[model samples]
Target chain A: MATKLLSRYPWATSPFVIGAPMRVMSGPALAVAVSRAGGLGFIGPGLKTTDTGVDLEEASSLIDKARASSFKTLSSSSLLPVGVGFQLWSDDLSTAMGTIEKYKPCAVWLFAPKEGQKDLDEWSRRIRAVSPETQIWIQIGSLGEAKSILQSSEKPDVVVVQGTESGGHGRMADGMGIMTLFPEVADTLASSHIPLLAAGGIADGRGVAAALCLGASGVVMGTRFLASSEARISRGYQNEVVRASDGATNTTRTLLYNHLRGTYGWPPEYSPRTIINKSFIEHRAGTPFEELKKRHDEAAKSGDSGWGPDGRLATYAGASIGLIHNVSDAERIVRDVRNDASRRIQGLAAA
Target chain B: MATKLLSRYPWATSPFVIGAPMRVMSGPALAVAVSRAGGLGFIGPGLKTTDTGVDLEEASSLIDKARASSFKTLSSSSLLPVGVGFQLWSDDLSTAMGTIEKYKPCAVWLFAPKEGQKDLDEWSRRIRAVSPETQIWIQIGSLGEAKSILQSSEKPDVVVVQGTESGGHGRMADGMGIMTLFPEVADTLASSHIPLLAAGGIADGRGVAAALCLGASGVVMGTRFLASSEARISRGYQNEVVRASDGATNTTRTLLYNHLRGTYGWPPEYSPRTIINKSFIEHRAGTPFEELKKRHDEAAKSGDSGWGPDGRLATYAGASIGLIHNVSDAERIVRDVRNDASRRIQGLAAA
Candidate 1:
């Protein structure tokens, strides 16, 4: 019904904003919490690499429980939107699809697929085969992809334009920023008429108002919301985001974090935004991959917490992370996005 | 020949880049002077709002002299691409055409016109009719405006996407900044079969490289050039952009400088970025037109040296003004832009 409604009115608003799928932070409880706060949420299907013993089944199980909670809430009220996401390049598609068949998500967002394998047709068809209403929101790092999506037969229901300042794996070639990419995509794809959402360095309502002026109907904030109470991030991790500055975050495509977790075999182009810790600094210029592998294997067994400014773990954040300073409730973050936009708009009109 | 060649390939390396026509600052001397430096230049037939005491006779005399210099250089070397611009909203069609005939510029740039003006067709016809080989460039504030230009009959040879940080008048509707605005336009227009240039907030080569990544073929810098020895700004003024920090500048749409200089009659939606100062703080909110008029009458008679921060006149700069450290020659500015972009790109690639 939501799909039918969205298709009927392309310009209509949606209170249903799914949390951008973070690897470890967002899960079943987070999804339910966001829905309770009057917005949609998602379960991150982390990096589902083709390798064995990764245990994605746990996240899938949590979703089933969330559905039960959703069902109970819907018994008294309306159904809420919920979803999952995958790193298209690193993940195992067949196993992932099996979970999707059993527990249908409201949407599935994908990012950083292999250069030669942009199998949009197969991916779109498979998701729709299970449930045609489920949206396939693909994150694009450049305008070329935005145009390609508009022109492709497997047209995305919603396009997410991520700037270089985005926290996770992003495009290095022509990594257009969010500000220019949003409005230009909005103008060119006006004919295709898909709902556009901005996802990069957006922390507050002023960011939301700026996006709206540049042509987005709404925004998707990641690091900002990561500090929410419902998110499963460490108290220390959440505090770091609150304390970070625009100048503090360092971006790179290195596999330091993946290696530290014993998670190798990822694409070369996609870099993560993390703070410059001692370990990264020591090894960044070049540490023998063998030495890095040994260090990574030891750290994975010990748990990532032992790592600090001198640790191996990466702390991913967008440029807007500087604007955040508090570890507040998720509901307050949502309210800030709404209220700040209203303030700027009203301020301009009054002047 | 060079003019025609540049039209065919605007991004092709050349010492002579056409100086963008600007209200108040642009004049016959500006056009010819820039051309003398081996760069093409234009005379701004600013809107009726810009009262520089420049009559048609004076404008024609300047153009005539520039043409003589251009022809002398062209005969000895290659022809210079001199041009004129019109504020599309402020002037009538007859006036635009009459200026074209009397001054005979190689091209015409249009800016900030009312939507659906019938004069577009007339001006388009006159431009091609008089100088069929002449190029037409249109300056637009947003990507939506770029899309609008594609629909217009007179497709510009080059479309300048002017972002909010520009020194001149622009849509303050939410202040979507240069970082977001540039890439959006560049990526969207990459497929349009025209070369794109990034403008606003560009001070050096890192900016140029970033623009390239955002899909722009070139960059147009205004603020950095304003502080150059070749530029007509005050000696004290050049020192300010050199020593200022990013925090020193704030964007506002006040007409303080123009009012102090006795210029007015601008549209309400347009605003420009200005550095903050004491008098600006006192009247930053804005003053009544009558109150401003009274203040201007006194300042003119006294001939106040509006040179420093506390003076009534405002210093306009983009966010990147902090990068500047000295008032170098215009040629050095160009060299630095090329060098900085090369180093950043090299460093990123090397990393």
Candidate 2:
């Protein structure tokens, strides 16, 4: 199955762009929209649940709907194959493998493994055995992790190099920027022949073009798609992404937001980049965690008004927020970025 | 002077790739080599003397030698119009102005102004009055500083956006990456029509190409050229740059290296990125500054051998060290990067 995917990789009409499997935000609808527009898209980890199993059921239904809708829009040769992601550390293996067996996604994105390469190897093997057509895609934040992946017994079919400027959880202490990291990783893994995808801080055509220049086979954009109508994000969060500029000033990597939202148990090595708000300001001023959480909860009740300067909610985004302005359709975002990148590359060649 | 430079900017064959005015490293030879290779280059601020007039005299001689040599290789139309840089806070303004007037450099790079925009405006005015043909280029690290530049009474011909990943002095507390900062500054100043250049962690063709995608009219590389034969860098430092990889693990931004080298007095808002050595390890382990400095001074006497893992000397480099594998001629570095970027851009377009 991996071989089949690799065979088709080089002949794609446009440079591959992935709708990153951002937890909660990236859904089957978004995935179908992107894949139908000639890019790969993934249903994120949040769709897989442990207790009631309602999330998985909904995901299965959405996947069915997406396939029908995508088949009508895309050519038969261009596969509208939706990928699926799983948080390796928290997700139950049997449940994930069972779901994969049921859906047979084109790709499986594994992230935040508790046992690192050991778990990654196990997950890859399991996915391959259950659904041979599913290619393994592992996300790494640093060169050390990339090296580990290369040294593993079972290698991934695709490597996603996520830089610190990425919106969600990434390297906490040491992470190189995509401009340098992507090329270095590409150079180091040149012999492997595995396709590399760049993520983090990429928002538009310029970023897509730049990623290609940096030796990436494709680019996976999480933040840019967050502003898409298909993304399952709040109006407040979407508004913040549109209004924001200068990510260095507006966003901070912190575990505070996750803790406030009652989502905990993520590895200590990672932190999400969130837009700075009153909660973050108060946290920096030495306010106790309990007090801040209380304020955050109170603000959450206010709905859309709960995420501004005076609000206390997380607005997950990357530094590339400055480039994102309006909320548009998922297909428009993907198509525009691809067309713009193509034009820019050709323009550069002419110049 | 600014008007003439601005008028000629659009006609440059390739996107400008400046050998940045790295203090003590970027010399007249490097500036001339880059200029001869179809890019702008600047002799660094180290040539500007505070009290003694010897430095300026030596610079004048080097410039003369560079011109004579450059004339042999470059066409008359492609003038070796070398630039000059100054540490505005420390340099004696009259002496620096007098030197610029005599040399009639094509551009002037002003850094570390004590009074920010006010000082920058005054310097721009002074340089214009002395040499009307010399373009003013200011380096900034944040959107706020860019805004300040935009609001200044006298605008510069070019703005160099220096990210935290840069090698030398840059914004410490609130620096943004070029991917986001460049586009934001570009959009904000679009109405003004000021050309923006990206600096920091750019080493090879991929970096140059990526910077172009990020909306930079040019790129200013300090560390990439440090490995060039024309740069005035020590063999030890150059070797480390070639050997280093995984910039996230190898390089760190700290004032410890600056203090150890007895090159203190930079403003509190700046720090330099250097490869981790004995001094940095000890500093991280809580060694007293006095002890670290003593060890560093002792290691400096050992010459080339004093810059490795056990050595205490600084190996200043950007996070792009992984891409720099060898020390090559300045002209080769410039031409190869340009050609490679052109090829990559074209290749992507075809793909």
DockQ of each: 0.04, 0.70
Q: What is candidate 1's lDDT per residue for B1-351, written digit by digit as tens?
A: 223445442322441244566654555555555545444556666546233225334544654565576434422322224566777667666656655655455567776666532445456767777666666767766656655656667667777666554565665543344554554455456566666666665565545554544445456666766666656566555666675543212434556765655556655556666665544665656756566556545543443344345444556665445556677766456655665555544443332
lDDT of 1 by residue, A31-94 (tens): 5555445455666655443221233344445534655765444223222255577777767777
Highest DockQ scorer? 2
Candidate 2 global lDDT: 0.79
Backbone clash pairs for candidate 2 read B1-B132, B1-B133
Shift in Å, residue A295, candidate 2: 1.2
Interface RMSD of each: 16.0, 1.2
> Residue B342 of candidate 1: its Cα lDDT?
56
Question: How would you class the docking of model 1?
Answer: incorrect
Error of 1 at A59 (Å): 8.9
What TM-score did chain B of candidate 2 earn?
0.91
